[model samples]
Target: MKKILAALLIVVSQNVLAQTTQKPVLHGKNWVAITGKPLAATAGAMTFQKGGNAVDAACAMLAATCTMWDVLSWGGETQALIYHPGQKKVFGINALGVAPSGATVDYFKDNDMEYPPAFGPLAATTPGTFGGIITMLAEYGTLSLKDVLEPAMQMAQGYPIEAQTANQIESNKDKVKEWPYSKAVFLPHMGEEREAPHAGEIFVQEDLYNTLKKLVDTEQKALSEGKSRKEALQLAYDRFYTGDIAEEIVRSVKEQGGLFEMEDLANWQVKIEDPLHVNYKGIDVFKLREWTQGPALLQSLNILENFDLKKMGYNSANYINTIYQTMSLAFADRDFYYGDPDFGQASPMEGLLSKQYAKERAKLIQERNVEDIGPGDPYPFQGGTNPFKDLLEKRKDALSYFEPENPISGLEDPFLEEFLLGTTTVQAADAEGWVVSITPSGGWVPAVIAGETGIGLSQRMQSFVLNEKLNPFNVLEPGKRPRVTLTPSMALKDGRPFLSFAVQGGDTQDQNLLQFFLNVVEFDMTVQEAAEAANINSYQMQSSFGAHESKPGAISLSTQTPPWVRNELKKRGYKMDFQERTSGPINAIWFDWKHGTFWGGSSNHGEDYGIAW
Candidate 1:
């Protein structure tokens, strides 16, 4: 009997290890590249193979993903967190576009719109990805602009369109037809049953190719004239913002009835700033400041630090409830306080990120769910007074008319659908100790193409609010960036690189990231196990996209959750929804300093892929 029991124990242990992850963790000794598409990951690998560092490889991957329209384009925004080995510090890249002149709260309200339009040329801000890419290359990267852009330029000439993007175009053809320039490029098969390209069809963008070539040409000309590398790169940047390319962009946008003027493009510039960080359990996590929703994750981590999460047990009813409540607390502050730091009344970032504030917020979690969670007064922590006390009192009434709707028999929940609006993520790391995490988004499908440039205009304007009560700091204003959902994350332990990670789902970006971090740090899960792990999402926060709808008390769980766990959550007042997979296509790299290697993980949730060597 003892012999039989010993054999059974060994078998069970092996099975438990096997079931931990569906995808294999990529082990690398030199470098690793991961992103939203396989081809884009390959682009990063190609750059790495050519002796480019992680920053150069990351730039190549970003450019390729933009060219492929992997939920983004050249006209979209790019937000990144890069770790420099020599400095032993993480830097923030604020390449997000600013609202163009004339895009004020009064301008939107005068059109009888509660918020900016969700699509078309009128929805665009000044393009930022081009400027962002050049800035990173000129500052930290060793490669020339031509070397990093070669793969994307070739792809812009022609590449096979993936089914997901192709089908997205076909389904949104009606809206695409509304924009003449977009219709000309997207509807190659006009009048046919399928107006968009079929899967695997060679999708070509001649004008986009020429636009990229023009930047390369300008850089080459400057270099031939004995300009420094940085000077040559600056010349290319000037050509885009102030030269002929700017002229064409202004003319095309205006012709399409957009509000863009020459100054909008010419005056726009990318800013490199210090990123924010909070140390949790000796591990330092870094994210961009309030302009994006990055700080919310830090806030959540700070709150969770007060809990004995591992003792609560992973995915237990207790654990899920704790996480959901903590996220609600952090996100409530995010919706009300996070916005462009350069504009409007300054947000109390120091107060909001205060450890004392998190401890106070953590005290609010009770045995039952807090359905009416509202923003907390954080000003006192930083020695300031609350200026929007009246607004806080009237906040609940703002969305009182839209009661939480019950799930219909077979219909999709519109709130959930919009809540999960996703983009693509990029992560790259090299043996030289450089690491990059990025969440570039906007200019997704149904985007309006600027005439002759073949570049789709970003629809990120929809993220703004016209009412001060909803988010006073984020209210629409000319040249002010709207509060965005794109967030990339990184962690360091004992002053050494620990993890580089990011995800796609819009508002769920930080929610998923917070859990992914805990899975590895607290539970000892492998990077792949952490990436593919089931996660629960909270829908208590206001949507950042169309209509800005939210459903309080609603929560999504993995279908794998047991019946008893579901019943326990229901008893806690959560309206439970389930999915086979709740992990947003999370991509991560674990720096194994002990082993002197890298471990890469890409979630099986989507087309996200990674390559390592």
Candidate 2:
């Protein structure tokens, strides 16, 4: 009997060690609902149908998405903004959380080796992003918190498993190894030992369910009692921050040596600031600053303005080369200067976005084949070319490039490891010619402070560092939100909202944004066509880190572009990389200022679908 039991256990262990699934795919257009995910979209769309404005719909969807798709949810923070044509005001909300008041850099000085793996406790910043939604609802939204939270509160109560949800849970099981609470909430069906389960599995979260029950009860009861808006919001915030849920998180973070403080929670405030605004060729562009690398998004538009993108053809090799030249310069600046403006000043804003810099940078995009041009305004390393064609090649089982066992680095062909952290973006427009663009995420991992609140703090710490060659007074510190790779954006031409867009796949975000923006703004493609157009991701060309030296300009291009475009780009001194899809799908909405109603479109290059009513 003992021997038989051992054999059974062995079989079970092997199954747990090996789990796989088709990666989740959620794509859409028309921007009916925009939040952290599709689940949020569904919830928000329902609210919209129930007579909510974009802000109401967004707030509701964002809250619900935090629970339904909490992988990118609260317990961390959310920094978001909106432009309302009806009000003609750009509202900004900083929903980011704050670091523990007591924690300091000395905390990490004692344990550099164990220093919370960048995304770990040492990376704990703040978790106040949802405050943005709260502030928006209070200021611009029509519905009460009770009305908006219903969809989210409902989803938290014993919700059935979604295929994508289950798949994400399974795919991220290894990530759960550090937190038992997460294991219980996610791997409930995986046996007592907490292991990965097969597909079609039904996992339940009793603790999360209870947490949802409290949130729902407060929300539902508020509506039943016809509570005032302030009362309802206070109730919700109290439940999350001052009640049991808050205690639960505080205990967790304390145990983890995190820097979160109750005062940070108590004094938490979301302020409405103006977005970083700029104009390009009669188009107005805006990106919320502070927590996002939004300036980078704007810089792309500025640089493209210096070139004649339309003359190069939409996906021509020369066109893609110009893109590489522009973005590499922009990103080089991003790596050097971007940070929390509250704590530091960014010098690159002037030079990076300047037409003079763009003109200087344009010279590097040689018309004919040119030899390796040294990286401009970029970190110095080595060899590479922007090979746009590389992204177009087909990918299947073997495309992952790296498996657990391989753990590759310093190879003949270096990988852009930065691609590991995924992000989410939404671009949609309202019927009133108001465009909506939002980028919400904490990159992969906890981004990583845990056990503090309902959600883990973001691991956005790795992106910031001290500058050696430039200004000083910027010492890495606690309580500061690190500048992110996210740069959700929009553009206006002749005082009309021309484009609503965002690129959300980490390092690829900026690259994809540059190409798609040029494709539409300069190359005259439709919104959908612009997003779908073939392009290259500069990261693949330079391989993020290792090949930053040896990386030839290997551009990762989508396969749809003309073959001649690839050959021509190569002839123009550019290197090409082939990936089935190099850039991530971009979501966009454009408003015809002359026309009263809004026109929306979805990117066809990926799993995108759009809607407008």
Candidate 3:
């Protein structure tokens, strides 16, 4: 009986790995969790110390986060990228929203709107993020839903508004002027704001609190009712999406000129995606696939590994120039072909990363002058193709067109606005492994609301192109997800989880990840140092495709780079945003092999985030 019981443990453990990540590594019984909030990170790590694994910790933190941060909430859809070390497989969770059955490009054109607004009920989609968290916890964690969720529930009922959160709300207060629901939640009172939202002021969300309770209570009842894991998950999902709440949401959207229906909500499914895998030198760096710009990080690494960066020197004139030019090529491909696998497909990893293509693309760089690059086929990009193109177009044509006007001429976008919009959480556990998740759907603005159902929807559609574009086998579909720049990543040495990371800053996310990947694998730098170093970011889109585009060679260098290195890139005709620091909040965890100690943290910058334990 003893032997049998032990064998059962092995089997269960094996299956857990199969469900969550691709690479698992160990360094003693230590654990780490990092996110935007210090309290939440500590809360998740507490679960780990209390015998919870990564999944349990993540579940706990995500719940707590909904109340603390509005970046990606239960109010909005969530997309998760997870890595399980024991299974040697990386898994991606697409918790993003789905368009209604009635959605079409012409729906907006008839209404005289160029692009969909990022707020209100019309922007609402089936929020599957919370449901997704529950699924992951049940399948890969040991804690009960009730046990893991209690902290967040309590926090949600009356979590104090944080200073950073309050500041963000204060900064973007104008965006909420249209929605009374949003103002009531964010602006509790006049001046004399509480010292801190978390410590003094009482931040209340009665609806969110009640909503969380229903999920926890329903999960408990399902368990008592003797339901299977999958059954219980469906119950909770239906409760929020297809059951009573969904009905209410649909009604509300109707009043607000929104595009949502029961069928569209029902059609939403969590897709299991192939992890973005790359062999950099001998080590493996796993990331979310081309659905995001994640593969570009690996592609950059593949080329950099061929050259000794330190030899060229860190942040050296030549080194920075080479990295910039290489990154531009990857970005050009990204803009031309990347989109949701259900929408358009842009293969970044194909023959594109080949010695032939790499050498060919690299030849485009003179290491002196910036050569302009739009979008081109290096080796016939064939990452993967979408299967729903023909059907999508038919569905789009169902709607009629309104008054047609000439496209906006002469740099139509007349706004001088700088944007910083991204959110993420990084964690690791002794028994479970490490996790790096960038749950970015929207930025810090009116796009989200305090107590609204779909708190500021993710501006993911912004990643889509206005022009009809063709990828290898994928094309842009109205309202479909754009090829994002979010990449939750892991560093593994021979199938062992070494480090886990995800950085903020749109296009900078991949660029930042590449630097850290090399730091850990090539330069033998600690995770902290790698993430702490300065960053050089390239453009994901044309920045703005008004009447002109900032094509390749139109790269921007952060001012933090020494003037000498900056001069080299400037002389090459690259644009620059000299900032005190133009990087992002890079969160990460590292498991040391020789010392048997695990140390991890979030970036020192990005004032909104922190690391605990």
Note the clash tally of each candidate. Answer: 0, 52, 16
Descending-lDDT candidate ranking: 1, 3, 2
TM-score to native of every candidate shown: 0.96, 0.78, 0.82
> Is 1 or 2 the stronger prediction by lDDT?
1
Whole-model lDDT, model 3: 0.59
- Sorted by TM-score (best first), the order is 1, 3, 2
Each prediction's whole-model lDDT (CA) = 0.91, 0.56, 0.59
Task: Report RMSD (Å) for each prediction in the order shown.
Answer: 3.7, 12.1, 11.0
Error of 3 at 111 (Å): 3.9
C-alpha RMSD between model 1 and the true structure: 3.7
Q: Report the candidate with higher TM-score, 1 versus 2.
A: 1
Superposed Cα deviation of residue 305, candidate 2 (Å): 2.0
Encode model 2's per-residue lDDT on 110-132: one tens digit a residue. 55532233545545555564556
Q: Write the per-residue lDDT of candidate 3 for residues 508-582, one digit (tens) a residue.
A: 677777766666665666666666666665542343111213334434455567777767767766655554454
Candidate 1 colliding pairs: none
Please give the distance, in angstroms, between residue 64's alpha carbon in candidate 1 and its true position after superposition. 0.6
**What is the lDDT, from 0 to 100, of the residue 357 in candidate 1?**
98
Model 1 misplaced regions, further than 4 Å: 1-19, 404-411
lDDT of 1: 0.91
Give the winner by TM-score: 2 or 3. Answer: 3
lDDT of 1 by residue, 1-613 (tens): 9999999999999987876578889999999999999999999999999999999999999999999989899999999999999999899999999898888888888889887998887789889999999999998899989999999999998999999999999999999999898888888999999999999999998999999999999999999999999999999999998999888888998898888888988888899999999999999999999999999999999999999999999999999999999999999999999999998688999999999999999999987888888899999999999999999887777752235455311115666666778889999999999999999988888898888888888988999888888888998888989899999999999999999999999999999999999999999998999999999888788989888877788888888999999999999998877888987799999999989999999989768999999
